[model samples]
Target: MNASLESTMRVKSSTEKDFLKLSGVNAVDVGYKYVDGKRTDEICIRVHVTKKKKTVYKKEMIPAEIDGIKTDVLEGTYVPQMLSPKAIDELLSDTVKYRPLKGGISIGPDRSVGGNIFTGTLGCMVTDVATGKPLMLSNYHVMCIDNGWHVGDQMNQPSLIDMGTHADGAGTLLRAVLSSHVDGAVASINSGINSSAAIVDIGNVAGTATALLGDAVRKRGRTTLLTYGFVDGLNGTVNIDYGDGIGVKTLTSQILIRPDTTINPRFSNSGDSGSTIVNGDDKVIGLLFAGSSSAPFLTIANPIGFVETELAVFIEAGLQPNLSKGGLENE
Candidate 1:
C-alpha cells in the first residue's frame, strides 16, 4: 500500500464518527479521488451521503480535506437488496423453476410472515466444513425472514415471491450469521434437488480471493442477471436498513462496487442480494448483500473471506458437479 493511502485510511477512521453524524451522510470509506467524473490516482477519504445538497449548515459542511487528506462526497442510500411485493408481482412472468438448481438463480425462504413473499439470488454451492453436507449460500435476510425463522426453515427456488404457491421446495436453512460485518446464510440442499457449482452466467469459481481496490468484478443475480463492476472502495462502514424488527444495521469492512459503464449500467438491483461477486479470473471475492439507490447502483458486499469464516463453509474447494445438459458451461 502507498504511504499516502495508508495515511488517508487512518484519517478516515479517526474522523468517521464526526462525518457520519452530519445530516445525509450514509457511509465512510477510502478510495481513489474522482475529478470531472474521471477517476484519479490520488487516494482519499470517501464520504457517502444519501443526497449531495447544494448547500448545508456550516457546522455540517464536510471539509474538502481532512487532516490534509482529500475527501470526496458521493450520493448513496444503502438498503438490503431483497425483492419487494410490488416487484415480485411485476416479475411473476419471468420466474422459472430450474431442475438442477445452480448459482445466480432466484431463491428464498419457504414463506414469509403474514403470507408475505420474498426473493433473493442463490449465491452459490458449497460444503459444510464440519459436516461436509452440500449447502446453498444466500443472505440471512433472504433465508431467515425474521426472528421467527429457525435453522430448519425451508427454502425454495424461484422463491415463493416469484412462483407464488407453485414454487418447489429446495433447501432448509442450516446456519446464518448477521453481525457487524456479514449478513450471510446457508441452507442444506434437500434430497432430489441437484445443484451445480457454476453460477448461471459466470463459470465455476476458481476460488476465494481478497477484493482489492479497482479489481474488475461481476455477478449473476436474479434481477440483474450478469452485470459487470469494479471495486471502488474498501473497508467501508455503512448503514443499511434490513426492514422491520431487523431494523437498520451498521456493517463494517464492506467491499464497495461501482458499475462498469462500458458493459453494464447497473451492477445490481432488488432481488440481487446473495449473489456472489467474482473477479476477472472467476475467483470468488465477495458476497452481494446490499446496495445503494444511486444511479447505476452502488453494490455493497461482505468480503468472501469473512462470509466463509463466519458461516464455516468452504466455497472454492467444495462441490464440482457437472453442469446439466443444455446448462451453463465455463468458457
Candidate 2:
C-alpha cells in the first residue's frame, strides 16, 4: 500500500501533539480527500526500522517550522538514533522523512543495508508522452548499482502521495513496492523526462540527473530525506563569451536551500543516486544524481523535463526491468 511515502497515511484528525508522538510502524490507515469533501481511508506503511544498529548516538526533539507551518524537528545525530520510530514521529510532522538505513529499526532481519542503502520517493508517478503510457521512474542506475546502472535490476519509487494540509494543495496517497528491478520503471517513472538526474563522471554513473533551471525540488536519499534546493545553469553546454574572463566548464550550483527545507540528515548519500526528487505539492521533481562532499560541496541534479519525451518513448516500448543480475545489487 501507500507505505513508502510514510506521510500518505497518518493517524486521523491528528494534532501537533499527536504527530509529536509519532513513531515508526509497519502499516497503518490514513485517508486523503473524500468523496463528499470528507476524509477517506488509505493504506500507509510506517517507515521501517532496521536491526543492524549497535548503538544510538543522539536523539533530541527540536522545534522547527514546516513551510511556514510551525512544527517540531527531531534529530538523530548518531546511527542508532536515526531509526527511532518515536523520533521519526517528531520529524514527520505531516511531512515525509527518509530515515537512514543503518538504523536497525527499519531493516528486515534477512536483508542487509551495508553495501548500499536504499530510500526512494514513494508518492509520485511517470508516464509516456507519445503513447500516453504510464510508468514509475526512479533511475536506470537504481536498478543495478554494481558498476553501472542497468536494466532488469530492482529499485524503489513513490506511488501514492498525501500532500497534507497545505495552502491550495490536495492530499494524495497511493501504494507500491520495490523489488530488485523493473523492466521499464525508469521510462515509466521518468516518462521520458529527466527532471531528477544530474551530471555524473565517475564512481558508477553516466549522464546527469535532469532538472529545470530555477525549479524547486526535493531529494530523498539513502542517508537523508527532503533535501531541498533549486536547479542552476551548470551544464555541459559550450559557450565562449568574449566579454570578460568568463571561462565555462566550471560547473557550479551555489543555490541555497532554505534551512527549514533542508534535511538535517541528507536522505541519500554517496551510493544514493536513484533516490527520488520531488516538488511542492508532493510531485516528482527530479532524481538525486550527483554532488560532492568537500567544503561547500555543491550538489548537482538532472532536469526531468529534458528527457521526459525520451522516457515517454521508452514507456511506449513496454520494457519490464528485472534486476536478475545487475552486478551484486547489494546482495
lDDT of 2: 0.28
Query: Per-residue CA lDDT of candidate 2, range 194-262, in tens?
Result: 221221110111212433334555554433433555432222111111111322121111121112224
Sequence-dependent TM-score of model 1: 0.93
Q: State, as a TM-score between 0 and 1, how close model 2 is to the true structure.
A: 0.34
Choose the strongest candidate by TM-score: 1
Worst 10 residues of 1 by lDDT: 322-331
Q: What TM-score would each prediction reach against the true structure?
A: 0.93, 0.34
Query: How many clashing residue pairs appear in each of the predictions shown?
Result: 0, 77
lDDT of 1 by residue, 161-246 (tens): 77635447887899999998899999997676667888887868888899988899999999888999999998899988777788
How many angstroms is residue 223 displaced in model 1 relative to the true structure, after the best TM-score fit? 0.5
RMSD of each: 2.8, 20.7
Q: What is residue 198's positional error in candidate 2, in angstroms?
A: 22
